[model samples]
Target: MNQKLLMAIYFYPRGGSSQVVRYLYQRLEKKWSSALYSGSLGNKGLLTNAETFYRPLNVKSLDYTTAHTAWQKGTNPFDTENPMQASLEDRINVPDTLMARLSPEQLAKQIQSWRHLFSKELLEPALAHLHHLTPMHNAVYELWKKTKIITHLHGTELKMIEYIRSNPKLPFGDWWIEKMIENANMSNLIITVSPHDRDLALELLSVPKHKVITIPNGVDIEIFKPTTLPDKVKMSYWKHWLVTDPQGWKPNHNPGTIRYTENDLKEFYNDDGSCAPILLFVGRFTTFKRINVLLDAYSIFKSHSKQNAPLIIWGGFPGEWEGEHPYEFARKRSIDGVFFSGWRGHDDLPLGLTSSNIFVAPSVREPFGQTYLEAMACALPVIATSTGGPASFINTEPGKKTGWLVNPDDPYSLANALQEAVEDQNLRETAGQNARDYIERMYSWDNIAEQFTSTYQYVLSHK
Candidate 1:
């Protein structure tokens, strides 16, 4: 039998990292047998089912709650010592009853205990049979000491550590930082999604430069490619997404609370009844994403521009946001021509991009703006901040520009870019085409998968 590749992550099918794992596994399955181990919140719907989310790939859910009980029962659930015929599902449970009641400190300790047991009982025994072990985050580095390990960073944990360090009053900040550094040091290879993150890992985690590799996130060009949807179909999409199946949540309100009326759709069309220019922003409403800053800039742009452009704020996980709720902020400022499309699955993003005119996200220090690539693939010109990953691709040159990269956190700069993009229809079309061409040539997921496979082979051969 071929040696199996073990992939582990602490999250379910939610973030960009999960998508990366899914895509890589799809491409690599032809080359090697693989199993994915991930955390489960117990929901058995299409969204939560590992088999459904990662179709045709072997998936194992590690219920830490069940593993915790098995630990107390004095029987190693992952033990191959007795050679029993128990299936992985038979040993795992859906609900984490004990974990739900724990305090923050207790929860941390419980996670640590689970990791220790997982490393010792499951990972250690499987090391000999495994050709490579890849974990999406560094928290599991200690688990694969005997195996060739590739540790991937998606930039959140590093940003958390940096924030914690800057604010020393944060509890256990120093200890967490030290633990992250130790994990990075122990890993055989470290891979981050952006060059900015690579530099941060080298500087903050103190990892050697040669040990780290920068692999930017990629998009599904096949899914996100530019195509014109019929007017009726496009309007139906906008209505269904904004009215029939609303997912936008207001601060301290449940999902779908922020619904749209017939009057709201008027702004989406021009005086001549044509589709108005639509500016889209997709991401979590986190502090660093600067959703409020984008709102401020949009308000400024609307005041100065003659065109009727509506800004569509597409995503924020239901009922979860930092600082002021975007809807409340908009209301307080009386900002018109701004619509919140709510949070939807990534599968629907192509429709959103294709139906829109431009993609704008004013996030400073964005780890890697994967949405920008997705939008670019759909031939939508991008407006992004200059500090992080988007800066690497978004060109600001006059005649040969793919998109605009403005100064981070500067509402005036973003507003200026918005004004320029909305006013010049020719510039928008040219930049959109250029954006599509660039992403096709460089950032397609097939190309990214090949790069990942080569890296895996290199690690396996060397180790």
Candidate 2:
């Protein structure tokens, strides 16, 4: 008989954590009898359809819960009195907050530690805001019925501020150690994408060393391939002459003409395009993603380089928070030779990767970075931080291994590594090949599926 496995995770699939979960689901479908996926697309970001990944395992329907919307009527899995819906004061679903599940004293002590943040001024407003964002109980309850719940933790840096406020004098205050610990303790199968995460989990969360599973993120190697178009994808004057009034760029300028297609990239010619190496940075524009650090590193690289100044391609989502993100810097500072393609889906990812010489993932607090693997799958060498998940599996041996792993916060270090990767074509090619080989051997979905299949069997057999 097929083993029943229930997975629970918050957030949409488009996010880093869910993306890993999605990968696992794809790999381990046959071994598990049933699977459950959860979360909302409205505020949780883009989520893939359940049918796309879960239906083959005989999953009935994805149990969805939104913090912004009301939950539909249901039998409830948590078996709580407050079912159909819940106000912020009525329920708290986060596993970390489930410490409220403890004795009143435990809950009180946890709250007392945060009594400062809730002082006469901030507490009421924060509560008001939180209450306003409270999700429905029916949604949470339905999620509890799943056989295996898989939640990928994204936005660790953003989440750190609140964690610090709650437990200030806590050890490793600068890092999200406690949060990692909480997840490591709570998750039946805590799969971290990075080795740093695995290390931090063991150190801070008090989880047994064996409980934490390290499954680095991956790329679809079959798709993304290298290209040899010297003049096809050059930056044109039209891209630089953008009209920015918040209404966005003007449409009459042959918007389609500016859009680069595979055919266009393959055939387009450039008068001055003498093939400057193209370097790419892909992922969200956030403090944790460290777009600013990347820009600074690029600037540093440019200053140091004497010849063949590399062209930089910055892709992915815009910053949701305030302040000037990389895209803003690229647009405002008129940073020449840099192109911003905003965000592109997986369908277009391969083409984009093929167009670049190297990929840089400079995230300050990435929970799991799949972009590096995707770049490698495309046969492009990656330069990433030795933090978060992507760095966990990276085997950087200069020109001998996958990619270069440098310190994230140090822009100078990043610049040095980036400079080397961009300048040496042979090193880039060899590292890229090694990266593809590593992903095929360890990070690919096939191996991940087998590991997950065993994990599911273990969880089911014991439970």
Candidate 3:
């Protein structure tokens, strides 16, 4: 019989972790049977539709909406009230007013309360189903107990709990820390996406090194490769994205709140009617992403550089960002040739990267810069920070430069790198080819799947 692996994650298929899970599930199915246990917020849009995205993989969505509603009405999960209701509010939609007013302590307590109820109502059922599959014989039960349960950590959860633990002033800090530690210890093998995250896991959760595995996220090279679209077709793609499917948003606004005009198209195209050298930034507008720093660098580069290359901002999930908004900073500085494409699904990212000239994201201490790989796979030269996973792959040598790697949080360094990338087309193309070659050899999902298979084999055999 094939080994059964259960992958449990709190959120539905939306973020980087879900993407990693989806790829791994596809690859792992060749050797082992697996199931996905995840919490659904009930949106099920193009982005959140795991059933379609992870097609053929057995996916069990623990609907948070139904569970939360049950908690609110004091209805037990065991009691029959059609407990897994299909239509309900998304659990992520906490009222803005309530969120803004909660103190750190109050917020932590509220989250802990929700997490407790969610575990009982959602997680327990999923785990119970797996348990039911095991035979009750003592030897078989012991062997089943040895079944490797891989808990994948994507840095955010580790950082949040660590922050609370280190800062004693936060309410329920100890409680949250203890809970996190318990969860970490429960896992047979803990997988972290980057070395930075593995280090954080060791420091924050006190997990033994033997139990932890560092596996960098992989890209689907087949999907994120350079496309051979005709110039006219490329122009149509630009029109469809910038004009037809506008996703740019304003501060505290819903997606599609900000849009572009036909005049905006001129900013992205050259006088010869071809797309200009587009510098792309893809990721959330979180503080650590240092989007303001990128803007500052772009502003400086634009002042001195002759190239009218546009910097296209490709992502910022609706109403979710920290520090100054990129649009606000751009407007304040009067930065030109800066376009926001808003939040888009991963399926649309390949075209976005293929159409762009450079991939730039100066995120500090990023767990693993998956976008960098995607951009590289799409044959775009990258500009990344020195402190994160990008450093592991991006070649920044003097002559054989695959991309530019600048100091974290330094606007001038990033500006110089951006200027260099914009000025030299030969360097961009040469480095882009190198980037594509490197991804094909090292970071493709096929290779990454093999790595996971090896890790899983080791974990299972030892257990």
| Index of the highest-TM-score prediction | 1
lDDT of candidate 1 over 1-463, digit per residue (tens): 2355666666546566677777666776676656566654334555545555666667765443344345447654333221111111111222222111223454344345435535533324221211111222333444455566677788876776667666776455576567568767777788888888889889988988888998877888899999987767788898998888888888767779889986788888888998888899998777888999999999999889878998999988665566788889999999998888887877798899999999999888888888899999999999998898788778834566898888989999999999999889999989999999989999998899888778877776775
Deviation in angstroms for 463 in model 1? 3.7
Q: After superposition, how far is residue 217 of candidate 1 from its true place, in Å?
A: 1.4
Q: Candidate 1 at 79: error in angstroms?
A: 24
Query: After TM-score superposition, what is the CA distance of residue 219 in candidate 2 from its true location, in Å?
Result: 3.2
Tens digits of per-residue lDDT for model 2 on 1-24? 334444444333344554555556
Worst 10 residues of 3 by lDDT: 128-137
lDDT tens per residue, model 3, 1-463: 3366555554545567777777777887676655555545445554555565566676766444554456557664322222332111112332221112234444344344324433332212211111100011111223334344566677766656655555667554575566557656766678787787788888888888998878888989999998766667776777787788788999867777777887778877667777678899999877778999999999999888877788889888777666778999999889988889888887889998888889999999887888899999998999999986788788844466789989999999999999989888999999998988888888899999998888877766674
What CA RMSD would candidate 1 show?
Answer: 7.0
CA-lDDT, candidates in order: 0.72, 0.50, 0.70
Q: Give me the runs in candidate 1 sitting further than 4 Å from their true place.
A: 46-52, 63-145, 396-399
Error of 1 at 8 (Å): 1.5
Candidate 3 lDDT score at position 334: 92
RMSD of 3: 6.5
Which scores greater on TM-score, model 2 or model 3? Answer: 3
Model 2 CA deviation exceeding 4 Å by range:
42-187, 225-274, 306-319, 331-334, 396-399
Q: Which is the leading candidate under lDDT?
A: 1
